[model samples]
Target: MRLRRSPAAVAAAVAALVVALAGTLTGCGTGERAAADGGNERFTLRIGVIGSGNRLTGPVGYLHDRNALVPLLAEAGVADITVHTFPNGPDLNQALVAGELDLATYGDTPALVARGAGQPTRLIAQAQVGMDAGIVAKKQGGPRSLQELAGRRIATQTGSYMHRYLLGALSDAKVTPKEIVHIYSSDVEAALERGDVDAAAVPAANVEALRAKGYPVIDSLAEDHPAYRGTSATVVTDAFLEARPGFVKVWQAAQVEATRRAKANWDDYLSFAVKVGGFPPEIVRRTTLAEQLPDTPFTEEGLTLLEGTKRFLVEQGFVRRDFAIDDWIAPGARG
Candidate 1:
C-alpha cells in the first residue's frame, strides 16, 4: 500500500534536501570562523617594515620572500599577507597610528616613542640585538673624534636608532653640537658630500663604504660605546592582537624557523642582506656576524637591551611619558 511520486515531485524533493545539507555545512563553517576569529574573521594581515623599495630585510624578509609564513599564518586564519615598507621608523609608526598596519618591525626608538605617545601596541618580539650605529665625517675637513664634533653641525634622521646613539655618545663625551639637522638616511651621503653637514650618524654597515669614499668614521657605538647599541623590535597593534589572538605565537614560531634557516645557510643570508641593504658583501657579513637573532621571542639579553633603550629615551625626553616595559610586552612572548 505505498504510492510512487511523479518524476517532477521527486526532483523537487531532491533539490530541497540538497539545500538543507548546504545550509547545515555553511552554519558549521560560520561557527568555526567565529571561534577562530573571536566573532569576526580577519583574512588579511598587514605588516610594516623599515626599508625602501617595498622590500623587507633580514631573516623575516628572507622567509617572507620564500612564502614560508603562508602556511604558518594560515593556521591563524590569515589568508592574505601584505608588507609595507617605510623610509624610517617614524613613517612606520604613522601607518600604525592610521590603522594601516597590523604589526611592525623596526628600530626600538620609534616603537618606544609611539608607546609613550599612547599608541596601543605591544612588543611581541625582539628581532635582532646589539645593532651598531656609527658616525661618519667628511674626510677633507671634519671632526676626527666625538669630542671634536662639539659646536659643529651634525645630521641624522631624527627619531632613529642612529639619532639615539649620536645623542648618547655626544652627551657622554660632554659635547654640544651647534645643530643636529634632521636628514633622511638615504640623503645623508649627499648632505655630507655637499658639506651641508659636518658629519652624519649612520648604520654601521655604511661606515665602511663611507670610509672607502674618503669619509672618516669618527665614532662607532659598537666599538667606542657598546652600551648604546640598538635593538630591533617586532610589535603588534592591540586591535589586531585582540582580533587574531593566535598571531603572536605563530609569528614567533615563524621567526625561530627563519633564524634556523638563515644560520644553516649563512652564505645565502649574507647574499640576501647585500641585495636588500645595498651594502658590500664584506660589510654585510661583518655586520650580520655581530647581530644576534634570538631563537625565542624574548631573550634575557634582548630584554635587557630593550629596557635600557626605553630608559634612555625617557630620561633624554625623546619619550615624554614613561611606560613599564613589562606591560608593553605581549603575553607568552617572554619565553
Candidate 2:
C-alpha cells in the first residue's frame, strides 16, 4: 500500500507540469449540481469495476466484500453502494459516459482514452501499479522473445492490460501487431495447451494455471519490459466530484482503509479471492496476494507509466486525441 515517489528533483519538475495540465482535464461541465436532498436522503454510489470481479485484492475488492463503503458513505449522507462489472476497460468507460457510473476502476489506457474523448472524469487515486503479464506457450517448444512471436498467433483478453502489454512488448522488440487471437482469461491456458494460439499474454494469476498444466512460460512484462508494466486506477466522474466532495473524500478514505485491512489479513484475503474469482487458490495467492496493492495520493512512477500509456494509445489510434495526464487526475491529488 506504499506508493513509491519520484526523486525530489524529478518530482519538482513534474509538479509544475501537473499544475499546467490540471485545467484541461474536463472540457465542459453540466454546471453545478443541485443542492443535496436532506441528511435523510438515500442515494446509491454506483461503481464500475473493470473485469468480471476482483472482490479479493484491490481497494474495491476489500471495500465491496465487507460492505464497508455503505457505512463510510453514510458519513457523507450516501446510503447504498452498487458495483457493476465490465469485462474490460473500454466497456466500463461507456457505462460511465452514459451516466450509469459515478466511480470506476480500470486500466490507465482506457481511462485516458475516455478522458481524451471528453468524458468528464478525474483519476482520484490509484489501486494498482507495476503489475506484470505472463506470456505462456505450449510446453513442448516456444519462441524466446517477442520478436520471434511475430506473425504467430498470439492470444490475450482484448481491451485489457494484457492486451496493451503484448502490444508494447511487440513494439519494443520491433515486431508489428498482427493476427492476435482475443479470448477470455479463463480460456488462455486451454488456448496455449491445445496450440489454438502459439502464445498467450495473460494476467499473472492465469500463469500458474498454465504452468501447472506444463505450459512453458516465456516472459513476464515486469521483468522484460518497464514501460508496459500494468496499472489500474480509481476514478470519479466529474459530476460526482462536483456534487459531493465529501463523499469522494470519504470514498478515498474507505479505499485506504480497505487496503490496510487487506494487507493485515493477507492470507485470508487471498483465500477469499479464490472463491470470488473462481480461479485456483495457489494462483491468487502467488500472483495477487504477493503483489503490492497501492493506496491514494497517487505516485510519480504511476504518472510516468500513465504518460507512456497515453502515448501508446494515441499512437495506435486507441485514443482519438491527446490529453494531459496531469489534467486527467484529481486536482487535489499530488501524484
Candidate 3:
C-alpha cells in the first residue's frame, strides 16, 4: 500500500521537526552533564505504553500488576511511578517527544521512527522478541492466501508492528492491495464483519480468538514470515536517563526479576495476562509463550532482531533516516 499522511501525521511531522531542531542545538553533552550532576535525585518516572487504559501485557505488565517495580525503582531513588496507555505506538511516541513521558514501552517500529526523527531516547531493553502478526480474513468469501489479497482492501492499526508486518509481507508476496485502511485494534473485528475490508492484520494474541470465531488465517509472521516478526522495545528519554543516572541499572534489574517470576510461575502469569490483556486464556498462553522475554535487558539475538527492524523501517521510508542501533542503546542495557 502507498503511504498517505493524514492531518495527524502532518502534525506529528511538525513535532518531529521541532524535536530534531532542539536536539541539534543542545546536543548530547548537556544530557551527559545532567547525568553526572543529578545521579542521586528522587523523582516520579512517567511511563507511556501501548495498551488499553493503564493495562499492559507480558513481563512488564506482570511486574506492574504485582507491584514489583516500585521496590526496584526505589533503589534508584525513584519515589513514584505512573503508567499511561496509548492506543498505538505513534501516539506513545508523541507523548515521548512532547516530554510528557519519561519512558516508553511499545512496538519496535514507532520507537525506531522516533529515534530516527531525532527524539532523544535510549534503548534500555528488549522486553520481548520474536513477536508475531497475523492476517485474518472474513469468514465467508475471504482470501485464501497473500496473493489473493491483491486488489482487495486491507486494514490494520497504523504505526503498529502489525502494520509493518503487513507491508513487508505484502511486499515479499509481491502483492499490491486496493487500499490499506488504518483502523484501531478494537474496531478491526467490526470492520471485518461489516466487510469494510477484505482482511485485517492483527496481533498474534488475537489470532486464535478470531479463528475460533470463524475468521480464516491467511498468513502469519511467525510461521510464514519470520523475518517480519515484531519486537517490544523499552526506551527512556535521554533527559530522564540524565536526571536519574542510575535508572537504567535499576530498570534492567526489575525486568530480569519480572522475566524470572513470569517463567517460574507460568500459570499465575497466564492468569495475570488474561486478566489485564482481556484475551482468552488459551490465546494468552499461546501468544505469551511465543514472546521470548530476555533474562537480561538485552540479548545478542534480540539486538540483532532490533537492528533488522530498524533497517527495514529505514529502507521502507517509514523512518526518516538511518541510525546505528549501538549508539542508541544506553549504558548498562546489555546486562
Candidate 4:
C-alpha cells in the first residue's frame, strides 16, 4: 500500500537527487547509464519498486537481473532501464514526486495521494487484482464475526490500502474504527502473536506464515464477495509517457505477456515465483494471482472499484476529498 510521504521524506529524496545530480555533472560518483552505446540512443526508464526486503519483490528484481526485461524493454526502445526499490510507501512516493520513477506499481491510496498532491501521475495499468488480506489472532482463535472484536485491539498501518480494507470490514459489520484499539503496522503481527493486540490485519503470505505457528484467522478480505475483490495496479507520470511513447507501449505489452503467462500457466508461474522470487511454494500457491479483464482493458468497472475505495477513504477521513475518477485515470484508458 502507498500513501503521501512526510515532508521529511520528501526532503531526503530532494537531497539525494541533488547529491546524485552533482555527482553526475562532476563525474565524481558512480553514475551509470542504462543504454546500449552504439554511441547513439540512451534509453533509460527508471522505475520505483517495493523494497528488496519484501519477499514479493524478489522475483521481479530477478527478472531484471537475468536480463528478461532487457529484450522486452528493448522492443519499446527502452534499451536501458533501472528499477529502484524503496523500503516503504513514503519513500517510494517521495521518489516518484521527485521524478525518480517513470512508472511503478502501488496500492490505490498512494496514486490518489500523488494526484491529490498535484503530481502529474496517472493510473495507467493494473499489476494485479484480488486482495490477499485477512485477520489473524493468537487467543481464542480467530473471531467468527466482526462483532466478536467489540472493544478488542486490532493492528494495521494507517494511510494504507489495508487500512481501507479494515475500515470496510468494520463498516460491513456496522462497527466503527473508534470501537477498536488501532495499532501501527510495524507492531501489528507481533502484537497479535504476543497477545498485545487481539487481532491484526495481514496479507496472504503473512497469514500463511502466521498460521504455520498456530495463529488463527478470524476474517479475510479475500472473500468471494464482489465488494472485496480488486487490489493494486500500475501508475505512471504523464511526463514520462510523453517522453517515451514507444517505451510505454512495449512496457504494457510486456505486462500483458506476463499476465497471460500468469493465468495460462499458473502452476509454472508459481514454481517460477518460488524459484526466482524466493517466495515459498506454499505461499505462492496460497497467494492469488490477480485476474485480467477479458480484453485486459483497464475499464470503468475497475475504475469504479477504485473510485469506491477513494470514496470510502474520504468518508472515513483518510483523504481530504473525493477526486474525480477521470483525474486519476489516464486519457484513452477506456479505449
Backbone clashes for every candidate come to 0, 0, 0, 0
- Residues 149-210 of candidate 3 have per-residue lDDT tens digits of 99998989887788889888998999999998888877888988999989999988777788
Best by TM-score: 3
TM-score of each: 0.87, 0.83, 0.91, 0.76
List of clashing residue pairs for candidate 2: none
Clashes of 1: 0
Q: Could you list the CA RMSD of all candidates, in the order they appear?
A: 17.3, 8.4, 3.2, 5.8
What lDDT is reached at residue 76 by model 4? Answer: 56
Per-residue lDDT for 74 in model 4? 76
Q: After superposing candidate 4, which stretches have Cα over 4 Å from the reference?
A: 1-40, 53-66, 140-144, 177-188, 275-279, 290-301
lDDT of 3 at 137: 97
Residue-level lDDT for 217 in candidate 3: 95
Candidate 3 structure lDDT? 0.79
Looking at model 4, which ten-residue stretch has the lowest summed lDDT? 26-35
Please write out the lDDT profile of model 4 over residues 108-144, one tens digit for every residue: 6655555554555667676555555777776555455
The 10 consecutive residues of candidate 2 with the worst lDDT sum are 1-10
Error of 4 at 209 (Å): 2.5
Output the TM-score of candidate 1: 0.87
